[model samples]
Each structure stands twice: as structure tokens, then as C-alpha cells.
Target chain A: MYMSVAELVDAAKKTKKPIYELVIEQEMDTSHNTREEIWDAMGRNLDIMAAAVKKGAEGEGVFSKTGLTGGEAVKIKNYRSAKKTLSGDLMMQAVQNAVSTNEVNSSMGVICATPTAGSSGTLPGVIFTLKDRLDLTRDQMIQFLFTAGGFGMVLANNAGIAGATGGCQAEVGSASAMGAAAAVELAGGTPEQSAEALAMAISNLLGLVCDPVAGLVELPCVKRNAIGVGNALISADMALAGCTNKIPADEVVAAMDKVGKGLPSTLRETGLGGLAATPTGVRMKEKIFGKAVDAKA
Target chain B: MTVNYKSVFDIIGPIMIGPSSSHTAGACAIGRAANSIFQETPTDIVVHYYESFAQTHKGHGTDYAIISGILGFEPDDSRVPYAIGLARDQGINITFIEEPEDSPINHPNTAIIELTNSKDGKKVTVAGCSIGGGTIEIRGIKMNGFDIKPKGPLPILLVPGSEVDQQNVTDQLTALTKVNEKKQYQSAKGDLFEYDLDRRLKPEEVKELAKNNTNLVYL
Candidate 1:
């Protein structure tokens, strides 16, 4: 509805312009880069993310990857004395309850901040990767996290990362987008290149939701951050390789808001539309009732 | 030629360093704050540990966060691996030391910073904390045994030890009593302003007109 001829671009330039083709205007830009700077940024962010996840697995806060505390480990060890197949429910439960994400914004305190509760794993997951996978020094990782945070801070102000407002696209999508942008910057991509990566992330995750099973953060959310982090890295790689998105990060954020507003409440966090009323949920409810009746006996 | 959206990425794409955006992101703000506090690149730094930042410092990469701050590392610089070595190469000595078990405890994320630049005999002690979301509160800093309090609205942010340091260090602190301060941004509302006929603007804009504009004038 809004139209400015020159603001849109000249008719002659429009014919010559293509989304990816136009990004090469770096010469006229002031955001010059030294190749080494970009690599360090990516390495640093990955380190911090990995470290955060490792911390969560260490049993701080609610994340206890090792479900078998001292009280239960001894009993489980004795019962499985002949442990040949190495099967244990405690191990399974630990995996289930351990090292996941949140449904709303969770606090990392002194560390980097994650988005919605459901995708809390995104930032920390990347940090863990840097620490275990790469040879990044401790300090470099810290700098990288700061750079990545700078990217996220802009988005946190510009975009809404909740399903209730901007949908899963805003939550996981924004995180992925922010990750992609930081990765690009770390790799020496120009500001425009970083924004393109962010755009791709937001567009890819458009229409995502915050539906959790039984209203618990345990299901789907944790895995989503892992996926989102991977996706953002991929997008950053693509952006760095000269690929670009047509939409701006700001525009995509606006679109996310519109889509979220259009989504039905049932499709949001409401249990009615998603996994809440699934067969698993029904079975769990039935088990609860059966246990209550048996206890009366 | 017409500029497209992807064109921007051609200049500045995003970075990929860590998991959480704010924690990792806020670290940059901390670095920036520390950098501003210390005028020159720090040669040596000791980040005192707090219980909250102590246990999780490693996991959150808090150690790296503060180190870059000392080295005057920019938020976008991704070469964090080389960062430590670069800092060392630049004669910047950085280390993390936890408080003694017997010492009095304070905020968990609080840090006691000791920055030394013996080249010019500039030694400073800054105690502060990176309270989440990139917000930093510099409780205080000392040049020597004497505390050099900030006199103006903004605490003395100058990293001292030069001739200017001695002159700026006042024996007594003239604490701000009660005076109207200017707003960060200009508007008809948020901050106090004069609504006189001679609408005063910025120093460049309003000029001394602001001093007389009784409505907008703090006096």
C-alpha cells in the first residue's frame, strides 16, 4: 500500500537487481571485515552454548541428566549386577528429564539468555558444541557469546519470541535467526549478510507453535532448540556462501506477528489441538485414575 | 541499482557463537562497559569470583566473557580461540581467581577487577557485576588505597594513573543532593522541560535558550 518510487529503487536498477546479486554492495559500506574476525565470533558462540548445556546436564536447576542420584544409583547398580544388555529405566528417565529446554523464557543468570521456555536449549547447545567439538580457547568463546548476544538483543527488541504473540517462528525461529546472524558476523559476513541469515531463519520457522504435551516443557521443546541451532548454523553457512533472503529481518519479524495473530488459540498452547489429548496423554490419565482406585483398596 | 534485502547480508551477516542470545549477547555489553571504564587496552586483569558466577562461570563461559572485556575485544570478533593468546601477545595478562573461602560474600555474579598497566603506572581496582541481560553496575573502582568517587552525574568513568588522575581525584565527595537532570531523549513528556514561547532545543539547537526556558529548565 505504501509506495515511493525512488525508495523502492529506480526502474532501470530494478531490472538489474536480484536479491542475492545486490548484496555485493559491500564496497560502499563501512562495516569492513578482516577474515579472521568472523571465524573467531562463530567459535566463541559455539563454546558458550556447549558450556551452558553441559552445566544443565550437571544437575544445576531442574536439568538433571543423571537421573540416578546416590539414593537410586546404588539400588539400580545392584539390580543390574549382570548388566550385559545394559538396559535401565533410570537411564531412560534421565535422558527424558535431563538436558532439555523451557516453554517460556528461562533465566541463564550470568550466561547468555535463551528465548522462549520451549527452546532454551538453542544457545547452550551451541556452546557445548564449541567446547567439545572445537579447539576454541575459553576467552575466545566468551567474546563470541557476547557478539552473538548482541545479535539476539536486537531481535528480542524487534521480534516477539512467544507462540502466543509471534508463534513458534518467533520463539525458535528468532533464536535460529539470531544464531545465523551471529554466525555470519563471526565469519566476516557484512551486516547485510548477517541480516539475510536472520531472515532465512525467521522465514524457515514461520508458523511454528508452542504446543507441549500435558502442559509440560519436557516434550518437543528441548529437541526443537537442538534442531533450531543446527538449522541456524546451516543458514549462516548458506548466507556466508553468498546466498541471501529477499525479506529483511525486520519485515520477517512483522510477518511472524501477523501469522501468530491469525493462528487459532487451539493451535497455540491449548492442549485441545496438539499432543495434549493424544493417545499417550489419554493412557497417562487412565493410569492415574487406576492408581487412585487401587490405592483405596 | 535497486538494493534488495539479501544485499545487506553481503555486508554484515550474523554470527554463531553460543546457545543463549542474551547471556552470550550481554557478555558483549560487559566487554564494552569494561572497555569504556579502562581507557586503554588492559595489560593485566584479575576477575574476582562470586558464588553465582563462580560455579556456573565455566559452563556459561563467564571466564571468556570477562577476558575479552580486558582485551577490549569487540562483541563481533569471533576469533575467541586466538583471543586469549592475542591478549597475552598484547601483554595483557588475564586470570580468574575465586574469593577466599573465609572472605565476606556478596552478590554471586559480582566481580572484583584489578587492572594494571604498569607501562604508565596506571593501576585501578573496579568492583562490579554483569547483572543479567547485559546490564552492568560498577559499584566502585580505586586508583590506590584512596577511593576516587565519581563527582558528576556519571561516576568518574576515566581509567586513571596519569597526571589527570591525580587532579580529578578529590579528597571529599560532593554527592548529588537534589537537582533536576536532563532526560536521555528529548520529548514533551518523559523528562522535565520548559514550555515557554522560546522553545529551547539542544545546545546546538536550544542554545542558552534552555537556561532561560523556565519550564524545561531544571532550576
Candidate 2:
């Protein structure tokens, strides 16, 4: 198995194969599944992601049970339609798509966890947005997922992709890095450039904490996904333009692991610190779950 | 260090209904694992949520997810939202208890489930932890006073028939794939044997085994 980004890039360069092909071969070797079976499974994931993006973008806005988060994606779409966004149409469209996926997730709709459900929106935000801009075919879209998965596997194994384990930097941060790497590949950058994108994306969000307000995957979580998408896009662009990270991608992942482990427990999805501990956050929690839960908090 | 992630799908998928993968999808998977080990329709089930699970069970729909899993629903099943009412309709007495804040559990997202088949008075207790990314680790199982902890999250095949059937089942399973661990226990129902395999069995292989051995249980 390709356990590190350096190893993945080295193998890709040696064999003259794209990272996605190496990942597919690794999957086939470990899982004992044929290429067709693996492709079909990833195809199913793509369909799910597309359905979620469509539902979030076009369907009636959904509200979570606690009413903490909802309708933001639709609101963004409406605002984009009525006025010119400062972030430009493409970036705003990506933001809308990312927020829509997370909104669907908040309302308990089915979503393919890009790495984890909490950061599900970021990768799809990058994928679908690029699909429209690049006019990527179905197979290219599938390859994008494979490339993302390839990098994600390394990050998860070498660091992690769980907020509880390594804070939001590990969850949304890893998703962003993976998306950036995949975006680079889809943009016709080299494997080394993909690694550069991955390193830059992760290092940019290295110390980010998992501070969901009121312990819900709303508030900062939904907005962070938008930021993640933007981070992935910008990093991908930089990598494609021949920018490089001083630190190697594998070392950056290791540093992220160290930083995440060093973070206090409160900053690690415990719901007792950061925005979750803010007065307004506590009040929102009380409004939804009632006053008794405040004592526990 | 050992790599926990094995496949691309492990990183990208497990299409699921979720607000949180750890709280919702992982909890559902733990419940499903416990149900699979239980190997029978439970008349009564009591779930004990600890730590992170207790803190956010309501908002994340973890309670509903766990119930849906115990009802044999997959993580992506649309019916996960209505699981509680469905359990009630099935005449299953389900109760959820949040452990006290001071309760000492190693993992943040842990759940202990106790299930009983009221008709036959068969009982099983399973403890599992949601270890993120829509994955779970079945910590251990308690049946007839024996605590069985199979290695990690390997595929488990439980057989509860007779002492003679143990050798036959083990032989059959060993021929098909590598058996990592095997244990035997005596219960009120009969002699129960457990086999943990190094890898998952193919659907056809499971079907063939089940067809040959009526008492075979695959988890």
C-alpha cells in the first residue's frame, strides 16, 4: 500500500502512471477486486455525491432538527442570481455547492463522506465545480475521486481524518488537501505538483481546531467547508503554476499529526471549548436542547 | 505503525445518512455489528451511550441511527430517520441510556448494547466504539458469562450448534480462508463456537457455507 505521498509520487514517476492508476492498482491488489468492480463502486459514490449536490443546490432548502443550520446554500444561490458576488461567479458557485452538500448532511440526507461526513462538502465542491468548468467526462470525474482517495488514504493512515482524533484540521483540513491534490491532477499537473498542492493545502490549515458551535456540525463547520473549497482551488492553481512547498507533503502530514495530538481536548470536538463554549453558542444549545444541557456543558 | 485504511473506498465512501460520520454512521455500524453477533431478532434492546456519543446523540441522530442498525438497516438506508417508530411497530422494547459524565470509557464514542431474545431467554452483550470515518471496532462480546474479544474488526463467523459441528465448521472455514482466531463456549442454546477470519468471505462463499451448515452465522 502507498502509505505516504512521497512514496505515491515516486511510484507514479517511476512507472509513468498517474496517481489514480497507482491507487486503483493498490486497491485491486489489497481488495482482490477486479478493476471493473472498483470502478463500479467509485461510480456509485459519484452518483451519490452528484445527487446530494443537486438536492442541496436546486431542491427546497432543508432545516436540521435543531434548526441551527439550513437554507444557507439556497440563500447563496439566490444571492448569486440577484447580484454579482465579490468572490466571482465560479468561486461563489463552488461555495454554493459545498454549502448545499453540508446542508443536506445537516438535514440527515444521504451524502458520501469525502473523508468524513463533517467535511463531506469540500471535495464535492471542488469536483462538481471543476466538472462544469472543465467539462470533465464521467470517467474523468471518477478519476478525480480516485486521486482524492489516494491522497486521503495516506493522510488518514499517516495522520487522521477525524475531528475527534485530530481536530478540524484533520477532518476538513485533510479533505481540503485531498481535494487540492486531486484538483491538480484533473488540471493536468504532474504527480509532484499534486503533492505540492496537497502539502500547501494542509499546511495552510495546520493548526485549525474542531470547534463546532453547540456540538452541532453546523455554524463554523458549514462555513469552514466553503473555506476548504477555496483553499483547495487556490492551492491547486498555485501547484499547477509550478509553486512548491518547502516541506515535503509527507513531512507536512506528520507535522499535522503532531499538531493535532498536541491540541487540547477541548479543541478536539469535545464541545466544551472554542465557539462551542461561547455564550451565544451555549444559548443556542439551550434553545434547542433546553436549559438542562447547559449544566452538562 | 500499521495502516488502518486499506482501500480507496475506505477513504472516499460508505454513502450514508449523516450529520456526523462518527456520531451517526459509525454508531449505526457498531449497532449493526452487535446485531450481527446477536444473530437473532431481539425482543428487547438497551443501548448505553458514553462520552461524545452521549453529548451529541440527539442532534446527530445517533440514537435513530443505532436503532436503525439494530433493525438490520444499512447506514445509507433512507428509513434511518424513522427507526425508533419502526422498532416500536416491531414490538421490540428499545431503551437508550446515556452514561453519567464521569463514566470511564477509553474511547470518546463508545456504546454498550445488551440484547435479549425474550422467547428463548437468550441474551448477548456487545461493546463497540465508533473509531471515525464510518468505521467501528467491536471491542468485545459477552455471552453466557464468557467475554470473547476477537482480534480487531476482522470478519467473524459464529456457529451455535454442537461440539461435533465445531470441527466441521472450522475445517470448512479454514479451507476457504485463513482463520485468525477460534474460540468455543457453552450456552443455554447449545455449544457455540466463534471463528474470526483474516479477510471477509465472498457473498457466494457465505451463501454456500450457510446452505451446508444451517446453524452457521456470518457477521
Candidate 3:
């Protein structure tokens, strides 16, 4: 089985199979399960993600318990319908889908944690929004997830995908990278281009911290997911357009790990510093919980 | 080295209800494993939270998730939010111990639960950690006076920890079923015994096999 993005791309090119098929083979070797079983499970996850998207886009999204993130997706939807937006229909749809997924997650609705719950919105967001635009089939959508999962596995093995161990760079940043790589493959780009897409996406979001206000996965988390999808889409386009990444995907992941290690714990989901320590952030926490809280509490 | 991600599902999805997967869904899995390991509903449970969990568990619903798990609620269940009230209604006493930030356990999302059964007053302690992405690892378990590092899912039979014949246990287990692997671990607490077998044993089959050996306890 491949352990790095370089090896994954090499294997994909050598075997003359898509990256998703290679990933499926890896799963078969490890789990001893048939391909159909694995595909059915992934199909279920897609259905869940689609359901959450529909639920979120239907109304002024349900406000989170902390009242930090909600209704942004619906607002964007309305804006797209009523006015000429610079982002265009496809990009706006991607942004809205991403925000809606995170909004559903914040409201305690069921969601598939794509790499992580904190960054769950990116892959499905880009995939579902472009499904019609790309004229993709249901199998193609599942293949998209498999390709993303393959890239995410590479990052997780080389670096990590957790905000606690790494930073927001590892969570949302890795998700964006995974999405970009899958988008490249789905768009019929070469395996080399997919790896380059990964490198581009990650480099764009390097050193981002994970300072959720009040330690809740709302606030900047939801909006960051929207930005993450945008980053993934643009990076995918850049890779498909034949832009070469100076740094390789594997080295970029290692660099992200190093940057994550350099960040203080306060900037890594502890809520002890960064935006969580801001005056307005503290006031919002007190207003929600009816008392001031210590950063170390 | 720490992860065992075998499939696409391990990375892309767990399909759970969540505000935070590390805190909520992963915590629920640990608690659910604890519930199953104890083999009965606990009359009382004491949980200890450490590091990031100690500080932000309330906001992330980590506590709610674990309690709901003890109450046999799935990670995706809607009843998770009201688990505390449900526990009280069932006459289950729950206590939480939040460790100081500096005196925390190694992992940021870690918990140790002590559960006591009502009828026999038997107790078990399970130490687990949520290692992010709605995944968990149960590090150690102390039950029936034995320390077991069970590597597999429940319906396991744990033998009491004593300076007993490892060869004898292996022989007996092999006689009962095909033993895949036998391993011994030494921790600061004491020695732990573990076995990976070719097949999972039913509780009744475990009892039948252990009828002559009083030290074996079905877990």
C-alpha cells in the first residue's frame, strides 16, 4: 500500500487505474471486504451529506446553540438568486454547500466527518456543487470520495489531520488539499496534477491556527469551511491548467506538520488564546454561559 | 504508527451527530465500549476528564456523549443531549472528575471511567482516549481483579491477573478455539494478558469453557 502522495501518484500511473480504484484496492487488502460493500458504505455517507445540504439550504439555517454560525448559506443562496455575484453560480453553490454542512454540524445534525468534523464540509461541498456542472454519475461521486480519502490518508500518515495534534492547517487545510486532489482526478487531470493540486491547496493555507472561540466548532470554523472549499476549487483549477507546484505534496505535508508543532497549544483548540481570548469572544461566552471563564478552565 | 485506518470510511466518515467529532462521537464510542465491556448496566460511574477535554468538554458535549453511551445511546442518537437527566431517572449515579490543566493525562481527549454494577457491587475501570476524527482507543481495562489490554471487541473472557501459568491459559484457550496470537504486556500497574483469537466466543460458550476455572470472567 502507498504511504505518501508521491508513491500514490506513481502507483496510480503505473497501474493505469484511477486513484480511487487504487484506494479501493488498499481497502480490500486491509479489510478483506468486497468492493461492493465498501462502495455501498460510501454511498450511504454521500446520501447523508446530501441530506444535510438540502436541510441547511432549505431555510434560514438553524442557529447553533452558541448562536455563532447560522443562516449564512441561505443568505448566499438568496444573493446568488437575486443579484449578479462575482463568485459565479458554481463557486457560490460550493460556498453555500460548505457553509450549510458546517451549519448542520453545529446544530448537532448528522454529518459525515470528511477527514474531520471540523473540516467536513470541504470535499462534499465541492463535489455535490459541481456534480451537475461536471455531469458526474453516482459512481463518479463515490469515486470522488475515495480519491479524497486516499489523499487524506497520505496526509494523515505523513503529518496528521487533527487540530489537537496539528492545527487548523492540519484540519481545514488538509481537507482543502484532499478536495483539490480529488477534484483534479475527477476533472480527468493526470495523477501528477492531482498531487500538485494537493501541494497548492496546502501551501495556500499553511500555518493556520485552530482557535475556536469558546472552544466551540462554530464561529470562524464554519466560515473557514466556506473559504476552504473555495481554496480547494481554485487550486484544482490551477493544477488542471498545468501550473506546477514548486514544493512536492509530501514535503508540503511535512512542512505543515512542522508548522503545527511550532504553534502554541493556545492556538490549537485549547481556546486559551487567539480569538477565543478576544474581548468580544469572552463577552459572547459570558452571555451564552452566564459567567466569565478562565482560559485554562 | 498510532492509527489503524483500514478503509475510506476511517478517513472520510463515521456518519455521526456532532459539533465536534473528537469530543462527542469519539467519547460516545469509548463509553459504549465501556458499557459493553462491563457486561451490564452500571449503577454508578465516575469519569475523569483530562487536558483539552477538562476545559472544553461541556461546550463540546463530551460529557453528554459519554453519559449517553453509558446509558446505551448510540453516537448518532438524538437522546444524547438529555443523557444526564435520563441517567438520574434510571437511578444511575454519575460523577465527573476534571483534572487540572497541568496535572492532565497525556492525551488531550482522554477519560477514565470507573463503573460499579448494582447487584454484585463489582467494579471495572476503563481508560480510553479519543484520538480525533471520531475514532478512539481503549488503552487498558481493570476488571475482575485483572488488568487486560483487550485488542478486540467485546464478548471476551478476562481471566484474573495473577502469577499464573500463561502456558496453561494458552493451552486451554487453544483447546477451546483457534488462537491467533498470544501476547503479554507489562505496565506500571502490573502484567496484562491478551489474546487474539480466530473467532469471537459467545458469553455462554465462554462460561462453558471456564466452568472449571473460576478465575475466568466473561467480559
Best by lDDT: 2
lDDT of 3 at A134: 91
TM-scores of the candidates are 0.41, 0.92, 0.88
lDDT of 3 by residue, B1-219 (tens): 223444567688888887888888888878887886686888998999887777778778888899988878888788988898988898988999888754233567788899998789889888877766776666678765566665533234555344474556766777666665456656565655666544446456666656655655443
Q: Rank the candidates by DockQ, best first.
A: 2, 3, 1
lDDT of each: 0.45, 0.85, 0.81
DockQ scores for all predicted structures: 0.03, 0.61, 0.48
**Which interface RMSD values do the candidates have, in the order shown?**
13.6, 1.5, 3.1
Model 1 chain A: worst 10 consecutive residues (lDDT sum): A1-10
Off by over 4 Å in 2: B1-3, B101-105, B157-198, B209-217
Worst 10 residues of 3 chain B by lDDT: B152-161
Backbone clashes under 3 angstroms, per model: 70, 0, 0
Error of 3 at A85 (Å): 1.1
How much is A257 displaced in model 1, in angstroms?
A: 1.6
Q: How many residue pairs of model 1 clash at the backbone?
A: 70
Q: Pick the candidate with the highest TM-score.
A: 2
Better of 1 and 3 by DockQ: 3
